[model samples]
Target chain A: MELFTPDSGLVIWMFISFAILFIILAVFAWPAIMKGIAERANFIDKGVEYAQEAKSQLDGAREEARGIIDEARRQQADILRDADKMKTRIVEEARVAAQTEASKVMDQAKESISQAQKEAEKNLRNEVSAFALEIAQKVVRNQLKDEKSQKELVETLMGDMK
Target chain B: MHQRLFRYMVVIMACMILPVFALRGEDLAGNSAAAHEEDKPIDVKEIIFEHLGDGYGWEVPFNHHKRIPLPVVVKGSDGKWHVFSSGKITDHQDYTEDGVTFRLAKEGEHKNKIVEVDALGNETRVTDMSVTKNVCAIFLTMVVIMGLCFWLKSWYKRNGYKVPRRGLGAFEALIEFVYNGVIKSTLKDKAEKFAPYLLTVFMFIFVLNIMGLMVVFPGGANVTGNIAVTLVLAIFTFCFTNFFGTKHYWKEIFWPDVPLWLKFPIPIMQLIEIFGMFTKPAALTVRLFANMMGGHMIVIVLTLLIFIFASFGPIVIGATSVVSVVFSVFMLLVDVLVSFIQAYVFTMLSTIFIALAQESGHEEKHEKKEDAGGGAKEAAAVTTL
Candidate 1:
């Protein structure tokens, strides 16, 4: 019991010493310690927030890059399709031009052949008429001489025919 | 290979620490043995009590004496202060001068009391405000703690808000553990405000407790184990809680939210609540004091067992010494654990009391809205209990 019993001097001293220690610590030590801890906590929290921001930004950049790649692929397919269409159009146009040129040449040859045939037919008709005329002239020359000599005889034959 | 690595670490740590522990025993035994005269049988109980209780000097057992006498300051009946060395008192004898007598009365209930004798031979008592061993220990604790705080501050400045490095790194963990684990969890939003007080108290008590276990002249004084010291710490915590208590907190204690029938019969709840306030600090005082004292006593008693066995014969002494020393060391290790635990419990309880007395943040805001005075003045009122 005496051990627990308070000594007035020691109690007074205890109160003084303890209060002094508490006050001094409150002013000097505790605030500094608590501040250090609080500052560190805030710093760590900020660090974590910044890291999260960086991660989201990276993700956004990746998504945008992927979008760009997709656009490039689509453009490539469009260019290939346009090239195929141009190739087919050029081939069709060239085939059509060659067919028209050959038809024009064939029509000219047919016209020339028709003209030549007409000219040849006209000459042959003229020649045939000349030949027939020559043969008739010869026959008329001989028959006319005989016709004059035979006038007398014809008179007699005419009398008999009458 | 891993187990080998582990063994190597164990060996290295043991190599570093075991010698210090061995030297500690040698230092205490060597000094005590040299100090005591062979005329009287060594009384283990008395020796233990002497070590546990406060004395007029520090106990390195130097100069073939039990203590190195500290300064004695006493106010004499002549209404003036008389300051002298405690070495003035002769061994077990009355010392007289200037018609005033001072004697070291080491018998009866008031052992080591400073008794005064008048010129007419009438005996009286004088107020002793001397720095005794326990007081000296308290002073030492303060010095060590103050030094540590300064070091921590500079570390903060040098490191620039970084986690402490080197020796302070270990201390930072303890500070953080108490802040995050104890103060923050118990005190919540107001934790930062009260951290300085609680942190200081925790470190002071813990350092004092660990010093008690050191069992050497510079290291050994049961400051925290003393009832007076514990009471002072408890009183501080008590003042902190009540002084800063909110109106809501006081209301919960002074009046209860109960039915009228119960209220009229007797304000049992209020009475109990009042008692609870005093008991809270009282419990804190006793818990720390008893735990530290009990642990020290156990270690002493265990070590004393070897001496008791030595009375029979050398053979018995030899057999018991091994067991006794091993058990004593184990008890000391347990004491070391209890020291930290008691310090932690005291700080933890103090925070809980403060938290209970604090108003939740929303209630504080609502109260602020209802008040029709200067916000700062009202805030000050809330903190004045």
Candidate 2:
């Protein structure tokens, strides 16, 4: 029972002592310690947030890298396609040029051949005419042996041609 | 490092041996002194009472004769203060003052009490307001708490909120526990504002309670076991809860949001609600005091069982002593756990009371709505003018 009953003096002392102790601790101790704790917590939060941001940035960069690779692939395919088209065009152009040159050569060869044939005919005609004149000269000389005979022969030849 | 460790072990061994030798010397001297008379039985109750209660001086066994004198202060009926060291009174057990004898009474209801006797032999009290052993313990506890708190404060200042690895890591867990578990769990968003008070109260009660469980100089104060001490803590909670209480809080006590019939019939509910406020603090007071004191008493009684059974014979006493020691050690372990738990419970409950005593609910929303309407109405009236 005495234990249960609190002495007033002790109560007063406790009251004042606790009040002072509480005030001192509340003002001095708690704020400083809590500040430290909050700062640490904030640091941790920032670290996590920074890590997440870096991860997202990495993802974005990876996507861009993929896009660049895809664009390079497309450009490569376009270059290959263009090379194929140009190669065929150059081959086609050479073939057409070669055919034109062959045709021109053939036309020149035909024209030269015709000209040579005409020349040959003209030469043959000239040779025959000369031979005919020679034969007439010999025959007239043997038959008449004079200007009279040549005239006569000329007249005879003209009468035979008429 | 190994050399340093060995040196430490040597120093510890020396300390242990020195204390044993001193105790043995004292026992030998006491035994020799007691050889002159029949050996008296040890009074277990008296030992327990002395340990549980405060004394004018700190007791030590120096040849088992006297105590170390502390200061004693008492106010005389002459309206003046008399200050004297305990050496003048405790050892001699006699001190004369102003025609009255101030001494320790060894009989009747005044046994172990300080009282004054007149020349005619009538005993009266002259206010035994001395800085007793318990007061010394209280101040020591205060010093320890202050030292730790201030030291940690400096540590934080130096380290800049870094998670303390070695310097103050011991306190970090308990501090974090109170803040996160008790303050955040109960006080919600208001935790930060009330954290300082709650943390301080928690540490004060915790250190004191843990010290109370110890059987040594710094340990055996039983400060938390004192009803007045618990009452002071409870009163702080009471003051904090009511002081910061909001309009909605008062409304819960004076005008609850119950049916009109319940509130208007006779204000019975409101009365009950008001009574609840005091009872909550009262419960806090009694719980801490009773738990600490009960633990101390049980441990003492268990230890006393050895002497109690010694009456049967040496063999009976020897067997009972083993059981007594085992049970006592078990209780002491339980006391340690209770000390921490009770401190935590008090802090958490106080935080809860703080939360409950704050402004929350539809009533606050209604108030805000009313304020907004009033502002608008005032603006319209001014415009009309």
Candidate 3:
């Protein structure tokens, strides 16, 4: 029978103790715990979002870097092509200048050689005239010295002239 | 695998049988020597009830006569409050102070309880507000609950939302299990509003249940098994359910949507609904009380089988003790599980009751649509109840 009875003192104690526990927990304990859980959840969520953003930015940067490398390669190819064209043009111009220089040297040398040949020919003519004149004078003097012989030689020359 | 399995079975059988034979030899000599003292037959019912009931003090292990005294606070017949150690009045001797005499009642309705006696030898109950064994156990439970609560609160304070590790982690898991698995799931958005009471009751009953299993010192008091304690807890649910009940909830109870014939002719639905309101808490009280009380009774009964079989000779006594010990051990393990279950069930039913009381017209319509979409479990629970 006592087992079935609800004692007044115990019921009162149960109510009082339970009420105190509830008040203490609701006011002091549960809020802080729930807040902490929410905050940690928020922190982790933000961390994941930031990581995703960083990854996207890194991907974009990598793409831009690849583009820049390609552009630099294209520019390098253009510069090399321009350098090749310039080298060919310079070589062609040098060859033309060299040919023109060689022709000019040949023409000047030919003109100088013609002038030296004319001078040498003129000197030889003069020398040969002078030598002939000297020989004629010697021959006249010898003939006078031998008048007799000279007279007979002059008759022979006249007959020969007729 | 078969051989190993056979070996284990044989070993277990040997273990069970070995204890019987070993205890047989000792009990044979003991029983013969104590045969003349068999006039006092074992009162299995009394022993079981004593174990299931509360006391003025805690029973000492291996000794029934000795106990650890607790304070007994009672109002005397002289209209004065008296406080003394329960040990003073336990010896069937009267303790008198200020011309008022009190003794622990030995028989009748107030048997084994502190009472006052006049000169004519008429025993009357004074306002007994003693911190009896159950009350002491309640205090111990409170201390444990507070320690756990503050421990959890401190973790949240220091670490700010980090799940605790080790023992505290296990405590957190239980908290979350009750909160999420029962309270939040049933009450949904309203869980937080009633969460304090719900969580407190859950922890309180749970701690009391576990302490009841210890059978010594801080445990052994069947606080939850006492109907008085369960009645208080159930009353709390009743208050929460009704006080916080919605207008629609009250409407559904008194002026239900049954046909006019049912409402006017016999008021059948109204009568049933009103009866249901009281029965809900009653069921809660009896469910928890009976479960805990029964678990304790079964264990005590099993252990009593040894003494009950004493007249059958030493072999029977020894064999019964072995079987009784094994069964009681198994029952205790089961009771541990029952403790969790009963606690869980109490909290869950309370949550559902509160949730039902919180119901409005809008949710009913929403639930109807939900039922079409395969969400009829909550509805079914309500209907079944």
Question: What lDDT tens digits, residue by residue, belong to model 3 across residues B164-256?
Answer: 899988888888888888877777788889888888899899999999999789899899999989998999999999999989889988888
What interface root-mean-square deviation (Å) does model 3 yield? 1.7
Please state what fraction of the native interface contacts candidate 3 reproduces: 0.64
> Model 1 TM-score?
0.77
Give the poorly placed runs of model 2, Cα more than 4 Å off: A88-92, A99-162, B1-41, B59-66, B87-92, B257-267, B309-330, B364-385
Residue-level lDDT tens digits of model 2 in B199-229? 8888888988888776666677778888878
Query: Which residue pairs of candidate 1 clash?
Result: none
Chain A accuracy of model 2 expressed as TM-score:
0.65
DockQ-based CAPRI category assigned to the predicted complex of candidate 1: medium
Sorted by TM-score (best first), the order is 1, 3, 2
Restricted to chain B, the TM-score per model reads 0.81, 0.79, 0.88
Candidate 3 chain A: worst 10 consecutive residues by lDDT? A29-38
Worst 10 residues of 2 chain B by lDDT: B376-385
Residue-level lDDT tens digits of model 2 in A35-151: 888888999999999999999999999999999999999999999999999999999999889989999999899889888988888888788778777787677557877788778
Ranking by lDDT: 3, 2, 1
iRMS of each prediction in angstroms? 1.5, 1.6, 1.7
User: Where does model 2 sit among the CAPRI classes?
Assistant: medium
State the lDDT at B117 in candidate 3: 93
Between candidates 2 and 3, the one scoring higher on lDDT is: 3
